[model samples]
Target: EAGVVQSPRYKIIEKKQPVAFWCNPISGHNTLYWYLQNLGQGPELLIRYENEEAVDDSQLPKDRFSAERLKGVDSTLKIQPAELGDSAVYLCASSLEGFSANEQFFGPGTRLTVL
Candidate 1:
Protein backbone atom coordinates (compact mmCIF):
# COMPACT_ATOMS: atom_id res chain seq x y z
CA GLU A 1 0.00 0.00 0.00
CA ALA A 2 1.85 2.98 -1.22
CA GLY A 3 1.14 6.46 0.07
CA VAL A 4 0.37 9.45 -2.08
CA VAL A 5 3.01 10.35 -4.67
CA GLN A 6 3.90 13.73 -6.16
CA SER A 7 6.26 14.67 -8.96
CA PRO A 8 8.87 17.35 -9.39
CA ARG A 9 9.82 17.92 -5.78
CA TYR A 10 10.93 21.42 -6.70
CA LYS A 11 10.19 23.86 -9.47
CA ILE A 12 11.57 27.31 -10.21
CA ILE A 13 9.94 29.53 -12.77
CA GLU A 14 9.87 33.18 -13.62
CA LYS A 15 6.81 35.22 -12.83
CA LYS A 16 4.18 34.97 -15.56
CA GLN A 17 5.39 31.51 -16.59
CA PRO A 18 3.23 28.40 -16.56
CA VAL A 19 3.82 25.48 -14.26
CA ALA A 20 2.11 22.25 -13.37
CA PHE A 21 2.20 19.63 -10.63
CA TRP A 22 1.11 16.02 -10.49
CA CYS A 23 -0.05 13.56 -7.89
CA ASN A 24 -0.94 9.90 -7.63
CA PRO A 25 -3.00 8.93 -4.65
CA ILE A 26 -2.80 5.69 -2.74
CA SER A 27 -4.46 2.65 -4.13
CA GLY A 28 -8.15 2.32 -3.29
CA HIS A 29 -8.34 5.84 -1.88
CA ASN A 30 -11.45 7.58 -3.04
CA THR A 31 -10.74 11.09 -1.94
CA LEU A 32 -8.01 13.41 -3.17
CA TYR A 33 -7.03 16.93 -2.26
CA TRP A 34 -4.69 19.71 -3.34
CA TYR A 35 -3.30 22.25 -0.91
CA LEU A 36 -1.00 25.23 -0.90
CA GLN A 37 1.21 26.51 1.90
CA ASN A 38 3.16 29.69 2.19
CA LEU A 39 6.47 29.80 4.04
CA GLY A 40 4.94 30.63 7.41
CA GLN A 41 1.37 29.51 6.85
CA GLY A 42 -0.32 26.18 7.23
CA PRO A 43 -1.59 24.36 4.20
CA GLU A 44 -4.85 25.62 2.76
CA LEU A 45 -7.12 23.36 0.74
CA LEU A 46 -7.09 24.43 -2.87
CA ILE A 47 -9.43 21.73 -4.11
CA ARG A 48 -10.90 18.36 -3.19
CA TYR A 49 -12.26 15.46 -5.16
CA GLU A 50 -14.48 12.55 -4.35
CA ASN A 51 -13.44 9.91 -6.83
CA GLU A 52 -13.51 11.69 -10.16
CA GLU A 53 -15.93 14.38 -9.11
CA ALA A 54 -14.77 17.64 -7.67
CA VAL A 55 -16.47 18.03 -4.31
CA ASP A 56 -14.94 21.30 -3.16
CA ASP A 57 -12.95 23.95 -4.96
CA SER A 58 -14.12 27.25 -3.64
CA GLN A 59 -10.65 28.06 -2.44
CA LEU A 60 -9.08 27.42 -5.83
CA PRO A 61 -8.22 30.45 -7.92
CA LYS A 62 -9.91 29.72 -11.23
CA ASP A 63 -8.36 32.67 -13.01
CA ARG A 64 -4.95 31.11 -13.44
CA PHE A 65 -5.29 27.73 -11.81
CA SER A 66 -6.98 24.51 -12.75
CA ALA A 67 -7.12 20.91 -11.52
CA GLU A 68 -8.40 17.53 -12.54
CA ARG A 69 -8.64 14.02 -11.18
CA LEU A 70 -8.72 11.50 -13.97
CA LYS A 71 -10.29 8.08 -13.46
CA GLY A 72 -10.46 8.81 -9.76
CA VAL A 73 -6.83 7.88 -9.31
CA ASP A 74 -4.33 10.46 -10.49
CA SER A 75 -4.63 14.21 -10.47
CA THR A 76 -2.94 17.23 -11.95
CA LEU A 77 -2.83 20.88 -10.86
CA LYS A 78 -1.69 23.64 -13.11
CA ILE A 79 -0.93 27.30 -12.57
CA GLN A 80 -0.74 29.43 -15.67
CA PRO A 81 1.12 32.66 -15.80
CA ALA A 82 2.11 32.07 -12.23
CA GLU A 83 2.77 35.19 -10.24
CA LEU A 84 5.51 35.92 -7.73
CA GLY A 85 2.88 35.73 -5.03
CA ASP A 86 2.19 32.16 -6.06
CA SER A 87 5.49 30.93 -4.72
CA ALA A 88 4.62 28.23 -2.25
CA VAL A 89 4.60 24.53 -1.63
CA TYR A 90 1.90 22.61 -3.46
CA LEU A 91 0.80 19.54 -1.57
CA CYS A 92 -1.27 16.53 -2.47
CA ALA A 93 -3.07 14.31 -0.04
CA SER A 94 -5.47 11.40 -0.05
CA SER A 95 -7.71 9.34 2.19
CA LEU A 96 -10.10 6.45 1.93
CA GLU A 97 -13.03 8.81 2.00
CA GLY A 98 -14.09 12.31 2.78
CA PHE A 99 -14.82 11.51 6.42
CA SER A 100 -13.05 13.78 8.85
CA ALA A 101 -11.92 10.82 10.88
CA ASN A 102 -10.08 9.26 7.98
CA GLU A 103 -6.44 10.16 8.22
CA GLN A 104 -5.11 11.69 5.07
CA PHE A 105 -1.77 10.66 3.57
CA PHE A 106 0.32 13.52 2.34
CA GLY A 107 3.02 13.57 -0.29
CA PRO A 108 6.40 15.28 0.01
CA GLY A 109 4.94 18.20 -1.90
CA THR A 110 6.21 20.23 -4.83
CA ARG A 111 7.90 23.43 -3.84
CA LEU A 112 7.32 26.13 -6.43
CA THR A 113 9.30 29.32 -6.64
CA VAL A 114 8.15 32.11 -8.88
CA LEU A 115 10.80 34.74 -9.43
Candidate 2:
Protein backbone atom coordinates (compact mmCIF):
# COMPACT_ATOMS: atom_id res chain seq x y z
CA GLU A 1 0.00 0.00 0.00
CA ALA A 2 1.12 3.53 -0.67
CA GLY A 3 2.52 5.07 2.49
CA VAL A 4 1.83 8.76 1.95
CA VAL A 5 2.44 11.40 -0.69
CA GLN A 6 3.23 15.12 -0.59
CA SER A 7 4.16 17.55 -3.33
CA PRO A 8 6.65 20.33 -3.88
CA ARG A 9 8.91 19.03 -1.13
CA TYR A 10 10.05 22.62 -0.73
CA LYS A 11 8.53 26.00 -1.27
CA ILE A 12 9.82 29.57 -1.10
CA ILE A 13 7.33 32.38 -0.97
CA GLU A 14 7.17 35.95 0.13
CA LYS A 15 5.44 36.89 3.33
CA LYS A 16 1.77 37.79 2.97
CA GLN A 17 1.37 35.52 -0.07
CA PRO A 18 -0.92 32.52 0.14
CA VAL A 19 0.51 29.03 -0.02
CA ALA A 20 -1.02 25.58 -0.23
CA PHE A 21 0.16 22.03 0.24
CA TRP A 22 -1.35 18.68 -0.59
CA CYS A 23 -1.32 15.18 0.83
CA ASN A 24 -2.53 11.70 -0.06
CA PRO A 25 -2.84 9.20 2.71
CA ILE A 26 -2.27 5.47 2.61
CA SER A 27 -4.91 3.47 0.88
CA GLY A 28 -7.66 2.13 3.17
CA HIS A 29 -6.38 4.22 6.07
CA ASN A 30 -9.12 6.13 7.83
CA THR A 31 -7.25 8.56 10.02
CA LEU A 32 -5.25 11.51 8.69
CA TYR A 33 -3.34 14.31 10.37
CA TRP A 34 -1.56 17.57 9.56
CA TYR A 35 1.36 18.81 11.62
CA LEU A 36 3.77 21.71 11.72
CA GLN A 37 7.38 21.18 12.64
CA ASN A 38 9.80 23.98 13.29
CA LEU A 39 13.53 23.55 13.29
CA GLY A 40 14.71 21.68 16.38
CA GLN A 41 11.13 21.15 17.42
CA GLY A 42 8.83 18.18 17.48
CA PRO A 43 5.89 17.99 15.15
CA GLU A 44 2.93 19.92 16.48
CA LEU A 45 -0.57 18.75 15.57
CA LEU A 46 -2.34 21.18 13.27
CA ILE A 47 -5.41 19.12 12.52
CA ARG A 48 -6.67 15.55 12.45
CA TYR A 49 -9.39 13.80 10.53
CA GLU A 50 -11.15 10.51 10.96
CA ASN A 51 -12.38 9.83 7.46
CA GLU A 52 -14.47 12.86 6.49
CA GLU A 53 -14.89 14.19 9.98
CA ALA A 54 -12.35 16.58 11.45
CA VAL A 55 -11.76 15.00 14.84
CA ASP A 56 -9.31 17.63 16.09
CA ASP A 57 -8.06 20.99 14.90
CA SER A 58 -7.59 23.06 17.96
CA GLN A 59 -4.01 23.95 17.12
CA LEU A 60 -4.75 25.20 13.66
CA PRO A 61 -4.44 28.94 13.15
CA LYS A 62 -7.95 29.81 12.08
CA ASP A 63 -6.90 33.32 11.17
CA ARG A 64 -4.55 32.23 8.41
CA PHE A 65 -4.68 28.49 7.95
CA SER A 66 -7.33 26.20 6.56
CA ALA A 67 -7.52 22.53 5.59
CA GLU A 68 -9.87 20.03 4.05
CA ARG A 69 -10.22 16.30 3.52
CA LEU A 70 -12.79 16.01 0.78
CA LYS A 71 -14.28 12.55 0.23
CA GLY A 72 -12.20 11.43 3.20
CA VAL A 73 -9.13 10.80 1.13
CA ASP A 74 -6.79 13.39 -0.29
CA SER A 75 -6.27 16.53 1.77
CA THR A 76 -5.09 20.08 1.28
CA LEU A 77 -3.72 22.66 3.73
CA LYS A 78 -3.67 26.32 2.91
CA ILE A 79 -2.11 29.31 4.57
CA GLN A 80 -3.39 32.65 3.44
CA PRO A 81 -1.25 35.75 3.67
CA ALA A 82 1.57 33.71 5.05
CA GLU A 83 3.79 35.13 7.73
CA LEU A 84 7.50 34.69 8.32
CA GLY A 85 6.73 32.59 11.35
CA ASP A 86 4.82 30.19 9.13
CA SER A 87 8.09 29.03 7.65
CA ALA A 88 8.26 25.47 8.79
CA VAL A 89 7.82 21.90 7.65
CA TYR A 90 4.22 20.99 7.04
CA LEU A 91 3.84 17.26 7.57
CA CYS A 92 1.00 14.98 6.69
CA ALA A 93 0.41 11.73 8.48
CA SER A 94 -2.02 8.84 8.39
CA SER A 95 -3.07 6.08 10.70
CA LEU A 96 -5.46 3.20 10.78
CA GLU A 97 -7.37 4.75 13.64
CA GLY A 98 -7.20 8.10 15.30
CA PHE A 99 -6.10 6.49 18.54
CA SER A 100 -3.92 3.71 17.17
CA ALA A 101 -0.37 3.79 18.47
CA ASN A 102 1.45 1.93 15.71
CA GLU A 103 -0.72 3.13 12.88
CA GLN A 104 0.72 6.57 12.32
CA PHE A 105 2.89 7.08 9.23
CA PHE A 106 4.45 10.34 8.11
CA GLY A 107 5.12 11.79 4.70
CA PRO A 108 8.27 13.61 3.56
CA GLY A 109 6.60 16.96 4.19
CA THR A 110 6.62 20.33 2.46
CA ARG A 111 9.10 22.81 3.78
CA LEU A 112 7.79 26.31 3.39
CA THR A 113 10.23 29.20 3.34
CA VAL A 114 8.71 32.58 3.92
CA LEU A 115 10.70 35.51 2.69
Candidate 3:
Protein backbone atom coordinates (compact mmCIF):
# COMPACT_ATOMS: atom_id res chain seq x y z
CA GLU A 1 0.00 0.00 0.00
CA ALA A 2 1.10 3.53 -0.70
CA GLY A 3 1.67 6.07 2.04
CA VAL A 4 -0.58 9.06 2.32
CA VAL A 5 0.79 12.24 0.78
CA GLN A 6 1.62 15.48 2.58
CA SER A 7 0.32 18.95 1.78
CA PRO A 8 2.31 21.97 0.60
CA ARG A 9 1.01 24.65 2.97
CA TYR A 10 2.43 23.89 6.42
CA LYS A 11 3.41 25.04 9.90
CA ILE A 12 6.63 24.11 11.59
CA ILE A 13 6.90 24.23 15.37
CA GLU A 14 8.69 22.75 18.36
CA LYS A 15 7.21 19.64 19.92
CA LYS A 16 5.72 21.33 22.95
CA GLN A 17 4.31 24.53 21.55
CA PRO A 18 0.65 25.29 21.16
CA VAL A 19 -0.85 25.52 17.67
CA ALA A 20 -4.21 26.44 16.30
CA PHE A 21 -5.79 26.27 12.87
CA TRP A 22 -8.72 28.40 11.85
CA CYS A 23 -11.43 27.94 9.27
CA ASN A 24 -14.35 29.96 7.96
CA PRO A 25 -16.77 28.17 5.74
CA ILE A 26 -18.94 29.72 3.05
CA SER A 27 -21.62 31.86 4.56
CA GLY A 28 -24.90 30.16 5.53
CA HIS A 29 -23.59 26.64 5.75
CA ASN A 30 -24.84 24.74 8.78
CA THR A 31 -22.93 21.60 9.61
CA LEU A 32 -19.19 21.80 10.11
CA TYR A 33 -16.46 19.30 10.88
CA TRP A 34 -12.73 18.89 11.44
CA TYR A 35 -10.60 16.03 10.26
CA LEU A 36 -7.07 14.70 10.63
CA GLN A 37 -5.08 13.11 7.86
CA ASN A 38 -1.98 11.14 8.64
CA LEU A 39 0.56 9.27 6.63
CA GLY A 40 -0.81 6.09 4.98
CA GLN A 41 -4.42 6.88 5.73
CA GLY A 42 -7.46 8.86 4.64
CA PRO A 43 -8.90 11.81 6.50
CA GLU A 44 -10.21 10.82 9.90
CA LEU A 45 -13.17 12.64 11.36
CA LEU A 46 -12.29 14.57 14.50
CA ILE A 47 -15.28 16.57 15.54
CA ARG A 48 -18.61 17.48 14.00
CA TYR A 49 -20.60 20.50 15.03
CA GLU A 50 -24.24 21.20 14.36
CA ASN A 51 -24.57 24.89 14.79
CA GLU A 52 -22.81 25.82 18.05
CA GLU A 53 -23.25 22.37 19.49
CA ALA A 54 -20.85 19.54 18.91
CA VAL A 55 -23.08 16.65 17.96
CA ASP A 56 -20.26 14.17 17.49
CA ASP A 57 -16.79 14.48 18.88
CA SER A 58 -16.08 10.95 19.95
CA GLN A 59 -13.17 10.72 17.57
CA LEU A 60 -11.41 13.74 18.99
CA PRO A 61 -8.47 13.15 21.30
CA LYS A 62 -9.64 15.23 24.23
CA ASP A 63 -6.30 15.24 26.02
CA ARG A 64 -4.48 17.21 23.34
CA PHE A 65 -6.89 18.27 20.61
CA SER A 66 -9.75 20.67 21.05
CA ALA A 67 -12.16 22.42 18.69
CA GLU A 68 -14.97 24.89 18.84
CA ARG A 69 -17.42 26.55 16.47
CA LEU A 70 -18.56 29.86 17.86
CA LYS A 71 -21.99 31.19 16.82
CA GLY A 72 -22.14 28.25 14.46
CA VAL A 73 -19.78 29.94 12.07
CA ASP A 74 -16.02 30.22 12.22
CA SER A 75 -14.14 27.41 13.92
CA THR A 76 -10.82 26.82 15.55
CA LEU A 77 -8.82 23.69 16.28
CA LYS A 78 -6.11 23.77 18.86
CA ILE A 79 -3.38 21.47 19.98
CA GLN A 80 -1.49 21.91 23.22
CA PRO A 81 1.98 20.43 23.67
CA ALA A 82 1.86 18.80 20.30
CA GLU A 83 3.69 15.56 19.70
CA LEU A 84 5.75 14.24 16.84
CA GLY A 85 3.08 11.66 16.03
CA ASP A 86 0.60 14.51 15.81
CA SER A 87 2.18 15.71 12.59
CA ALA A 88 -0.57 15.67 9.99
CA VAL A 89 -2.92 17.78 7.91
CA TYR A 90 -5.81 19.40 9.67
CA LEU A 91 -8.88 19.81 7.51
CA CYS A 92 -12.01 21.87 8.06
CA ALA A 93 -15.14 21.26 6.07
CA SER A 94 -18.75 22.37 6.03
CA SER A 95 -21.95 21.25 4.42
CA LEU A 96 -24.98 23.33 3.60
CA GLU A 97 -27.24 21.31 5.90
CA GLY A 98 -26.99 17.79 7.22
CA PHE A 99 -25.44 15.52 9.81
CA SER A 100 -23.53 13.80 7.05
CA ALA A 101 -20.38 14.80 5.17
CA ASN A 102 -22.15 15.11 1.83
CA GLU A 103 -21.54 17.97 -0.53
CA GLN A 104 -19.19 19.63 1.91
CA PHE A 105 -16.91 22.52 1.07
CA PHE A 106 -13.39 22.09 2.44
CA GLY A 107 -10.81 24.69 3.25
CA PRO A 108 -7.15 24.32 2.41
CA GLY A 109 -5.66 22.10 5.10
CA THR A 110 -2.67 23.09 7.20
CA ARG A 111 -0.02 20.47 7.71
CA LEU A 112 1.88 20.68 10.98
CA THR A 113 5.44 19.57 11.53
CA VAL A 114 6.53 19.03 15.13
CA LEU A 115 10.27 19.23 15.43
Candidate 4:
Protein backbone atom coordinates (compact mmCIF):
# COMPACT_ATOMS: atom_id res chain seq x y z
CA GLU A 1 0.00 0.00 0.00
CA ALA A 2 2.81 2.39 0.84
CA GLY A 3 5.05 1.29 -1.99
CA VAL A 4 5.82 -1.62 -4.29
CA VAL A 5 6.22 -4.68 -2.12
CA GLN A 6 8.29 -7.49 -3.52
CA SER A 7 7.66 -11.11 -2.69
CA PRO A 8 10.10 -12.59 -0.20
CA ARG A 9 12.48 -13.83 -2.86
CA TYR A 10 16.16 -14.52 -2.39
CA LYS A 11 19.03 -12.77 -4.16
CA ILE A 12 22.58 -14.06 -4.31
CA ILE A 13 25.11 -11.80 -2.56
CA GLU A 14 28.68 -12.02 -3.66
CA LYS A 15 31.48 -10.03 -2.09
CA LYS A 16 32.46 -6.78 -3.77
CA GLN A 17 33.78 -3.41 -2.66
CA PRO A 18 32.02 -0.02 -2.96
CA VAL A 19 28.31 0.44 -3.69
CA ALA A 20 26.59 1.34 -6.91
CA PHE A 21 24.10 -0.53 -9.10
CA TRP A 22 22.33 0.44 -12.25
CA CYS A 23 19.01 -0.85 -13.51
CA ASN A 24 17.18 -0.42 -16.77
CA PRO A 25 13.55 -1.39 -16.50
CA ILE A 26 11.23 -2.54 -19.21
CA SER A 27 9.36 0.20 -21.03
CA GLY A 28 5.87 1.34 -19.96
CA HIS A 29 6.43 1.10 -16.24
CA ASN A 30 6.03 4.45 -14.44
CA THR A 31 7.20 3.43 -11.02
CA LEU A 32 10.58 2.27 -9.83
CA TYR A 33 12.01 1.11 -6.55
CA TRP A 34 15.29 0.12 -4.94
CA TYR A 35 15.72 -2.41 -2.20
CA LEU A 36 18.44 -3.89 -0.04
CA GLN A 37 18.67 -7.46 1.19
CA ASN A 38 20.98 -8.59 3.90
CA LEU A 39 22.04 -12.16 4.35
CA GLY A 40 19.17 -14.38 5.42
CA GLN A 41 16.77 -11.45 5.29
CA GLY A 42 14.01 -10.31 3.00
CA PRO A 43 14.47 -7.12 0.97
CA GLU A 44 13.79 -3.72 2.44
CA LEU A 45 12.64 -0.73 0.46
CA LEU A 46 15.25 1.99 0.04
CA ILE A 47 13.47 4.31 -2.34
CA ARG A 48 10.57 4.55 -4.79
CA TYR A 49 10.16 6.77 -7.79
CA GLU A 50 7.24 7.75 -9.97
CA ASN A 51 8.71 8.77 -13.27
CA GLU A 52 11.77 10.99 -12.46
CA GLU A 53 10.16 11.99 -9.20
CA ALA A 54 10.91 10.18 -6.00
CA VAL A 55 7.60 9.59 -4.23
CA ASP A 56 8.79 7.48 -1.37
CA ASP A 57 12.15 7.20 0.30
CA SER A 58 11.36 7.01 3.96
CA GLN A 59 13.21 3.79 4.49
CA LEU A 60 16.38 4.97 2.82
CA PRO A 61 19.28 5.71 5.10
CA LYS A 62 20.18 9.20 3.98
CA ASP A 63 23.44 9.31 5.84
CA ARG A 64 25.05 6.85 3.48
CA PHE A 65 22.65 5.61 0.81
CA SER A 66 21.38 7.58 -2.16
CA ALA A 67 19.27 6.75 -5.20
CA GLU A 68 18.17 8.40 -8.37
CA ARG A 69 16.07 7.51 -11.38
CA LEU A 70 17.38 9.54 -14.26
CA LYS A 71 14.96 10.33 -17.10
CA GLY A 72 12.60 7.87 -15.43
CA VAL A 73 14.41 5.10 -17.24
CA ASP A 74 17.55 4.14 -15.40
CA SER A 75 17.76 3.75 -11.66
CA THR A 76 20.96 3.87 -9.67
CA LEU A 77 21.68 3.33 -5.99
CA LYS A 78 24.91 4.36 -4.36
CA ILE A 79 26.53 4.26 -0.98
CA GLN A 80 29.38 6.71 -0.64
CA PRO A 81 32.44 5.25 1.01
CA ALA A 82 30.47 2.13 1.76
CA GLU A 83 30.93 0.45 5.08
CA LEU A 84 31.23 -3.21 5.89
CA GLY A 85 27.71 -3.17 7.32
CA ASP A 86 26.44 -2.10 3.92
CA SER A 87 27.24 -5.49 2.44
CA ALA A 88 24.08 -6.84 0.84
CA VAL A 89 22.24 -7.28 -2.40
CA TYR A 90 20.82 -4.16 -4.04
CA LEU A 91 17.60 -4.82 -5.96
CA CYS A 92 15.84 -2.78 -8.59
CA ALA A 93 12.18 -3.12 -9.50
CA SER A 94 9.54 -1.43 -11.59
CA SER A 95 5.78 -1.52 -11.92
CA LEU A 96 3.20 -0.26 -14.38
CA GLU A 97 1.98 2.38 -11.98
CA GLY A 98 2.10 2.54 -8.24
CA PHE A 99 2.17 -0.27 -5.77
CA SER A 100 0.96 -3.45 -7.43
CA ALA A 101 2.37 -6.71 -6.32
CA ASN A 102 1.68 -8.42 -9.65
CA GLU A 103 2.79 -5.71 -12.04
CA GLN A 104 6.24 -5.31 -10.59
CA PHE A 105 9.27 -6.55 -12.54
CA PHE A 106 12.55 -7.08 -10.77
CA GLY A 107 16.15 -7.14 -11.93
CA PRO A 108 18.94 -9.30 -10.60
CA GLY A 109 20.67 -7.62 -7.66
CA THR A 110 24.28 -6.55 -7.28
CA ARG A 111 25.88 -7.35 -4.00
CA LEU A 112 27.94 -4.73 -2.15
CA THR A 113 30.80 -5.40 0.19
CA VAL A 114 33.17 -2.91 1.81
CA LEU A 115 36.59 -4.27 2.61
Q: What is the C-alpha RMSD of each candidate to the true structure, in Å?
A: 0.8, 1.0, 6.0, 6.2
Which residue pairs show backbone clashes in model 2? none
lDDT of 3 at 110: 88
Candidate 2 global TM-score: 0.96
TM-score of 4: 0.79
Each prediction's whole-model lDDT (CA): 0.95, 0.94, 0.82, 0.73
Per-residue CA lDDT of candidate 1, range 80-107, in tens? 9899999999999999875588999999
Candidate 1 — worst ten consecutive residues by lDDT sum?
96-105
Instruction: Please tell me which predicted candidate would have the highest TM-score against the true structure.
Output: 1
Each prediction's TM-score versus the true structure: 0.97, 0.96, 0.88, 0.79
Model 3: lDDT of residue 75? 87
lDDT of 1: 0.95
Q: Relative to the unseen true structure, what is the C-alpha lDDT of residue 85 in candidate 1, on a scale of 0 to 100?
A: 95
- Candidate 4, residue 115: Cα displacement in angstroms equals 1.5
Estimate, for each residue in 68-101, the C-alpha lDDT of model 4 and write its tens digit: 8888877777677566677677788888874755
Error in Å for residue 94 of model 1: 0.1
Rank by TM-score, highest first.
Answer: 1, 2, 3, 4
Clashes in candidate 2: how many?
0
Candidate 3 clashing pairs? 4-40
